[model samples]
Target chain A: MAETRTRGRAPTDPPASFVWTRRIVLTLLAVFTLVPVYAMVSSSLKPLEDVQGKFRWIPSEPTIRPYIDMWSTVPLARYFVNSVIVAGGATLASVVIAIGAAYAVSRYRFAGRRVFTVTVLSTQMFPGILFLLPLFLIFVNVGNATGLALYGSRGALILTYLTFSLPFSIWMLAGYFESIPRELDEAARVDGCGPVGALLRVIVPASLPGIVAVTVYAFMTAWGEVLFASVMTNDQTRTLAIGLQGYSTQHEVYWNQVMAASLVVSIPVVAGFLLLQRFLVAGLTAGSVK
Target chain B: MTSAKVSAAGAARAEGAAAAHGAGPGGSTGGRRRRRLPGKALPYLLLAPAVAAELIVHVVPIAVGIWMSFKELTLFYIREWSKAPGKGLGNYRVAVDVDGAIGADLLRSFLVTLAVTVLAVGLSWLLGTTAAVLMQERFRGRGPLRAIFLVPYALPVYTAVMTWAFMFQRDNGMVNHVLADQLHVTGGDRPFWLIGNNSFWALVTVIVWRSWPFAFLVLMAGLQNISRDLYEASALDGAGVWRQIRHITLPALRPINQVLVLVLFLWTFNDFNTPFVLFGKAAPAGGDLISVHIYHASFVTWNFGTGSAMSVLLLLFLLLVTAAYLLVTSRRRPAHG
Candidate 1:
């Protein structure tokens, strides 16, 4: 990679003072990035009096009470479970659906191929707000007409999420698939493998990193989504984003517990990104480079 | 069992290829054989489910939104929206006329959104590009610094914004405690960061913090794609770092910067999460972003027609901006290519 090459040569190195400047700047930037996060964690541990009293860099008497209380506070567990189910289901469904289309677009040359690709890219341009009213109306009308009970359900949120996620998944997967050489599929064919076999056995395995990136992207979108989830979900099906709103109201706000719940909600995604940083970076930058 | 069926199908395709080759001349036979393949429809079959889903969820809804913008959609008629009375251009007039109540509010929110998008994108791009370029040198703790830098982007949006919300609290918030009490930057009384006129800057601060990491990542990737040889040659020719960046690095990263700026602009412009989480359904006067503005109009006030009209105006404006951007970028590409 160019990064490695540049690092090896050290062509951009400056004087010792400049090095110190860079270190100081990077440190300052890192601190700027971390301060809010620190506040969140420290405040979560602090008692209400300490939080409202003098501000301390570190809590004087740290406790896990907020974390413990967060569970019983406001349906935190239910929101977490609901987020997992909706995000998980949306990710799986979108990935499954996108794989076939991405593979086809990457491997085949057919009529309307360019149009299909352009259509996929164009979907990203439309703002999400434009879709909310119409989709809500459609759901209401469909439920009333067909007795499907689609409104106020997790199914509605999952479906609504696909409006954004499906296009992105398809685009990312197609870029990944394109990077896998066509010769591999030819080799599979010569070994008595059909098109489906070539895709399933060769292409999918070769593109696992890309696939993982797409899955993570879809999951994150569904997980952190607030707009449609707030509108479409009722109390029983509320996702974590909507659930977090319960901590604050017109009258009062729970600062300590909100921080605790926020920390708990952020763990999976941050850990996931740290674990899969390489693949995610590669998959994200693939399309732009080409 | 699946492998057996797949192998059987492969065998039949092989035979078909062979037969077509035998029946036609050499040069054109490959095309003929491909055209005659029994799986010619497979690509379309594979594409159907995704295309169908997009059409139903995205395309159909957008069409419906446009149609609904012209109708009198309110809480009373929401149960059967199709039967709502059509208002033709009445909603559009109400949305855009600057003299009226709804129109004036929409216009104000639109200006606020414009300012927010411009400032947020500009500052984030500056910070991100500088950090990315600075980190290109061989430095100690670069790996750890990179990871630390990405935390803002990697962390969940709601979590990050929620933390910012807590920190911006007037009484117990760390921001005021540090600025006013500790540093003596202001008086002992904490300024209200989440409400009134101050909310705009507060909103901008949180957004810039959350979004700059994305710009950092993209610029970093673009920097990686640039060959080190160009910088080395420029150095040998006695050019300084600033000159090298101006003549080589900037030009090399032009394409990336274009797309990155556009994406960030769109996301920031249409953003609902930051404003929604920070301020509620009805944003403070100072921070009435268009998304929340429209949401308040439609959802809170239950005037779907006016809200849809405002949204349609936003959609058209964004589409125009995007088209203009793409055109200008495409025109410049050939020179670089």
Candidate 2:
């Protein structure tokens, strides 16, 4: 990887045309990437009439009215709270569960260990949509049979999100655990630490980056999920993704508020990504890249 | 590395020998002591929660979904879907039979899905490879440029799709404003991007924009693994940039690209958010991908059985594709362990 850095110019200057062409292409791609984001932010600041009327690159009369109205106009704040609860809960649960399984898979040899690894990988093969209908049916049936209403609940959404997030989390964290030398765990065990204790004190601290990566992955999965959220959530428990749909209905579209709320919903995840991008990239390309 | 491998192999043999000796009556005291403890069950204990959750949430539901497809489960029998009368391929016939109501739509949706996945994945792979290769060259502002390129992938799906939806508005969209008013590309006839035939292109544009960044990221990482000496060696042989990329870069990146394309194909085929958020309950005729089509059939029309059948067919198709993909890639790397 370090060699790739020196592969380009051989410590010599390239021609002026090559440099200019590179800069121009980079600038063009940057503009292409940033335009929609610019439009989103600028349009969010604009008044309703301006959003529906002319095409302005910058808002002539910029105001935070949309942001102010977003909370009062709909259940935007409620949805944000719901998203926080669901994503936070799911992230915590997924990381904890994946940590244990990943440790076992990475450290100890056991029966069906190969099968366990294969199962984790196979879960990624199935599309989430394939499970929707059956899961919905099961939830409804279980509710009716046992008087436990799982449908339209945050718990249900969290569980469904686990289906989407846990496989990748386990895969990534297991890889991270593998990279940590087994000597550390043995050393910890020799010093009066048991299997669980060594994992907590030594392995967990050493694998903080991987743990952070898994947490972000799980959080982002729960946060941005829409297909299941839309089906499984109701008015009181709607997530941010489902709640954003409130802006567009059969009657009227609230473009300004939608844009404002989109930004609000996106800030935490995007900030998380920017901060932990290295770990996130590592997690995403865990097995496939090598 | 060789020493590490040798030691690992020795450790495995030692463990196997210990287990084999423990089975006999005259085992070593250390082996007996190790077996006396319940530590052997620790791995299974730790794995229980994940396995349980996956089985309950994913596996069982999938089994139930497959069963549901054979029954006449609709809104009327949804509550008692367990007891719904078995239709014995009746639902499958309805889904695949061209003369039936939903059969034609199902076929059309499959075609649209195929086209969308092929185009979106192909274009994204092309754009991503080009951008990644370009970024490989040492240049000014490359760090920030790379980060900027990742914005589309980093943004939440709903936010990105909503922004595109806003941009794709028919009358007052920025797309029309730019093309019709500013650039005069369309000659005062603003195309309706959100509806009718053009929605396919609009949806494709949004998907391509969102997905290319992932391909770029993967390819960039893959590029890092390629020995730069190869490029220098090729360059020394008077090979042009294109030839070097074709021979050295593409072959080196083939493994990553294989996985990338398959994942992209599956994702784009099953993508529900873009079309759903952009078009609402029913996508335009031109843009009705199978995911949304199944979604509407089950949810909007309250035909669970038919939806399950369609989804089951989709699952089988994806399974075949994934198996074939793994087969091809796994064959290439027989040393994978």
| Backbone N/Cα/C clashes per model | 0, 0
lDDT tens digits, residues B255-312, model 1? Answer: 7777778877888888888898888788897788888899889998888898889889
Write candidate 2's Cα lDDT for A237-267 as tens digits: 9988888888786266778899999988888
TM-score of each: 0.91, 0.90
Per-residue lDDT over B104-208 for candidate 2, one digit per residue giving the tens place of the 0 to 100 score:
899999999999889999999988898887777765567777888988877878899999999988777899999999999998898988788898899889888
iRMS, all models: 10.5, 9.0
Off by over 4 Å in 1: A1-8, B1-38, B332-336
lDDT for model 2, on a 0 to 1 scale?
0.78
Q: Chain A TM-scores, one per candidate? A: 0.92, 0.92
Worst 10 residues of 1 chain A by lDDT: A1-10
Assess the local accuracy of residue A75 in candidate 2 as a C-alpha lDDT between 0 and 100.
85
Candidate 2 clash pair list: none
